[model samples]
Target: MGLSILGLSRFQFAMTTIYHFFFIPVSIGLALAVAIMETMYAVNKKLVYLKMAKFWGKIFLLSFAVGVVTGIIQEFQFGMNWSNYSRFMGDIFGAPLAIEALLAFFMESTFIGVWMFTWDRFKPGVHAIFIWLTWLGSTLSAIWILAANSFMQHPTGFEINKATGHVRLRSFMDVVANPQLWRAFPHVIFAAVMTGGMIILGMSAFAMLHKRTQQHDGDKVFFTKSIRFGAVVALVGAVFATGAGDLQTQFIIEDQPMKFAATEAIYNDTSDPAPWAVVSLINEEDKTANSIEIPYMLSLLSYHSTSGSVKGMNTVNKELHEQYDAKFGKDMNYYVPVTTLFWSFRFMALSAAIAGLASILALWFTRKGKDTLMNYRWLLWIMGACTFVPFIGTTGGWLITELGRYPWIVYGLLTIADGVSPTATVPSLLFTNIVYFLLFLLLGAVMIFYSRRVLYQGPDGEGELPAGKARAAERTSPVSAQSTGSVSGNAGGTERSVALS
Candidate 1:
């Protein structure tokens, strides 16, 4: 096994990332949705709007807590597992990362804490502002983190520090403002929105599926409105994600040709024309790809011309080795993991296609008091299936990215083998691995179970939730001036809805 250190680190990283991502999309989407509903309530002086906002805000709050905890772990892992990578790219990557920490992360974290414990204490108008602040911070945090990753794919505006064997910032502005960022970040944002949408739609569908027995008359109406809201938002996000994904494909072909070749399983080692394989492809093998393919699809994606060809992985690998030797005065291994990148890309594409179609079709069938078509048994089944699609999409995007950067921990500067602690023995790694694996398993299960309990057993269970919780009541029922005036807040607090807004 030589060590399995790489395998272990990869596993731990993936598990942590997947778990963290599950919480984020919902937090970002729900925050905005809640803010809009609250604003509507304040404007119209309608309690239904307030009830709607508070109920959904409760769900968002749950997602935020889990997201924050899981996210902190991801930041620490970069330093823990890939310390060498951090040292090498720290100057460049650390810029956006630091900004995210200072400008976005702390702001969101602080405001969220205020929002959570002070609903009864804050003014209604002021509280709404804090919510919006949290929402912006979350999304901004995403943009900065993504800016760092974009630099990896298209290593822009950095100078080599030969003495340190690392890249230094030639211009911090250049690293942060790469053109690649504009595309990748929006694509990720839309994907996040889609994940949020599916969760909303999936829950709404579950309620609808069991409509006859819903405990409260108000519950059915809320679920119906949510279904409309979710299906529409999901469809819009899906369409944006697909378009951005296409643009990303084109960008990858030009910026990381080897990765593009590896992803498509192009092994013939030629250029000037590229073919898009439409199905599964066998790698590190002889004979042709076993799949349907469009002869010039890759060409158009790569060069904006039907006749131009994309390079193959074999040829690109050979060239990379030659280039490494020529540039560094030494032989080097060009290790690109084909299978992981290949499957992850396909999974992302396919799942996205299905999610987009499902959302749109669901809306068309159910729109404008026209849900009979959506009442089809299969549509319900697909809606249920949509709950897991975001998980798949997030994981797929992650694997394609991290796997594509194999061998090198930080682009051309450091390899994974060089990143491990020399004094850290295999026995030590194994012990830690076992501990982390068990701990992680327990943590993941607890989060899922807790979240499910909140979703399934809390509202729909036997008893009604306690009143006087502004945010909690908002989600379960339409809030009125009655709710606003119900609480005698603590001294230095608003009269209605106790905790400080």
Candidate 2:
């Protein structure tokens, strides 16, 4: 059967949101990486760091451009496909989104241009400030956006307006200070860092493989340092992402028990020392799942103890039905998509673990100016192939976040059906969906094409080095070149001109 209006609208939103989100982390990650690389160049006055900053900055620009285009479309979706949601959430959402636009987006956009064009105008340390500000603006943008989303996950700082029957903001501070927002904010930030780090690490590995064949000693030094830098960033991000994820899970156990239960595929109430499911064959129709269990792990996961029992989906469902059915009325299925959440949670966890593992291996192998990584061609190939690993985890994590809150667009406040625009038709949704898919496909292809083109060109290639002054710096010592800001600026100017063109 064809999808109904609700189904099609939801699908379209889901697909578009996911696609938009895919680039967001990459932009955020690359921005911070570029900022740090530039800062290192400013501090140590190393031309190698300058080369890294310039090369990666191009990738960041591409990602940021696509992210902006996709994000603009997302804003329109609220009014076009989910007008009711907009009406209900207008008051609560307006402040943060406005702040994001007026303060964060403006700050980011303004400084990014300054950073790009003024590379030749400012001193190294002074020039680095612009990219740092750009990172701050982007991070702040995420914070405000997540504050609005957190309200949907766990409604706070709002009251029902009796006259309009819509939610109005009660305290802006409370909304921004939401516990859920903080939990989710750090998790997302760290994940983005990991995503960007993986990209750098993977690209470096790919370059190393090619550079070895061509016997380019300069390129070898560039990629080697880059690989180590990427490894450190990725490892730190993975560690923190995992920790932040655990905190989110703990919060979920308290604030959204149904979601926790669904993730574990638990149907029946468990004993005091509940076993954690390793894998489950979920039968949603029968409200049953045959799970491969780890003794006392569920208790540990839920309560951080091996003794306490947690409510299962069946129990949570019964309680929710009793609480909400009276107001919303009858046949309310409280059970979420068990199979989806179960695997999504696992995939997200596995992604983090893999990132952590790869990073540690990278660090160990390349310790103390060692060229051990060159010995493992297989490992380099694998690292290059695993560029998309963190993306998989991030996508799966979002799926669990959105889907686990089934039937409700806003927890305990609005149903998905009520939030969807009642006037939206299947035909319009289908047409938009097709258009979005094609548009995203084109953007993705362009991004990949340009990124590959950059890699193929190599770091020492044309436009990477400017004419007279940059060549003069190459002959001078690294420390001596610190005083030669004009020479370095010319190189940066060349990169900016190439990237922008």
Candidate 3:
């Protein structure tokens, strides 16, 4: 099959972006988690909390490092693959990215280093401040990044320069304060938090299982506390994520009705008090769907009541053609990938519900002197598997956000066809795509390897963990002098310092 430059460029970008985004939420979420763990240690001076902080901090650092590397590559693609889009959006888009790099990223990286290296140097409370700062910085970084993205979605705070045929920033405050940004940012942040919570809950569950098998009572206690903490965090994130997602969807109904319409696979104008499609058999060629819908649910969801009519794809497309035909072209297609949106929305929503349910069950089973949790091996398995589920939800949400925009790169201002770089060749794009794919595979493998290594090693660096199932704890008579006092495991002669370990 032949690869057009535009198609290749889009594919390459999609691959790189998806891979990059896989770690962004993880990093942001983990930063908060690590900070919370450290703060708990600071507040209680509990050795278990200290162990929790150190153990999870390793994963946080790894995620942050990989995210930074992938983010650099993501930024480069803007210039390399979408030069025309960059040239058009540079004045509007560049500001947030610049602030993110110079202010937010710099603050995050610096404090992260401090937190890592000076763990023992500062008092507990002071050292904890560094991680809290890192979390704040990472959060701020997300805000700036989303601010830039929101501008593309809504295109506010800018004026189209007639002479140059480019958008110019009219007000920085307005761009940063975009209503779309506020509506979307909470959903993303809470999702990130949920992502973090799931990872912690899963890892802790696995650790608990391993320790229980080994009959290491101390380790089991450590993991039990951690698992419960993770469950609370997960539940909070999941609950807020759902609420925020609903609010964002409500905004989308007004702001981007076609996107909302496509998500439900609605082609014809809906009756007043529209029905919500639970499932659909969509025909792309015919632009129609055979749906199983719930009465008035769509109207309730869209307008917070069961009264208003929701516009459908066909109706919106016709209106769009009429409005933009003179300025753009009559042949412009406003239709998006309906099937993808239909499935993605369901998957995203379902994943969030699953996450919430798992968290709730975990909390219930482990409640008030209940030793029943361990007996439910299936529950543990579900919790562990949930580590990967939030990624699916986040990925699906992003797919809807970006792909639903479809023909527009900077909605209404520029089309995706005209945004790609003219000079990008098929061969070069293919080569880079292959290279980046292989690189991502390597990164993924390394992350898995190291993460597993950390899990196997447990909170205590007493023994080297084998590649397979949990092994018996090998207690050493002599403790390592360099080992941190906070860790519960007996540090053997082979043990390294906490920071290095």
Top of the candidates by lDDT:
2
| Collision pairs in model 2 | none
Error of 2 at 263 (Å): 0.9
C-alpha lDDT values of all predictions: 0.66, 0.81, 0.79
lDDT (Cα, tens digit) per residue for candidate 3, span 316-434: 99999998899789999889999989999999998889888888888888887885778887888878888899889987998889888878888788888888888888889999989
**Candidate achieving higher lDDT, 1 or 3:** 3
Better of 1 and 3 by TM-score: 3
lDDT of 3: 0.79
lDDT of 1 at 150: 71
Clashing pairs in 3: none
lDDT of 1 by residue, 1-501 (tens): 236766666565666676666677777777777777667766776666665566566667666765666666666566667677667777887677778878887778777667655656766677778778877888888888777777766678899897997889998888777877887877878887777777777766665555342655556556666666777677777788888887887777766667777788776654556677777567454524565777777778666787787777767777777766665445565646676677788888877777777777767776776756334757776787787787788778777666676555555656666765444455655766676667667766866665554454323332234554535545443233344422111111000000000
The local lDDT score (0 to 100) that residue 6 gets in candidate 2 is 82
> How far is 52's C-alpha from truth in model 2 (Å)?
0.8
Each model's TM-score, in the order given? 0.85, 0.91, 0.92
Q: List the candidates ranked by lDDT, beginning with the highest.
A: 2, 3, 1
RMSD of each: 6.5, 5.5, 6.1
Number of colliding residue pairs in each model: 24, 0, 0
As a TM-score, model 1 comes out at 0.85
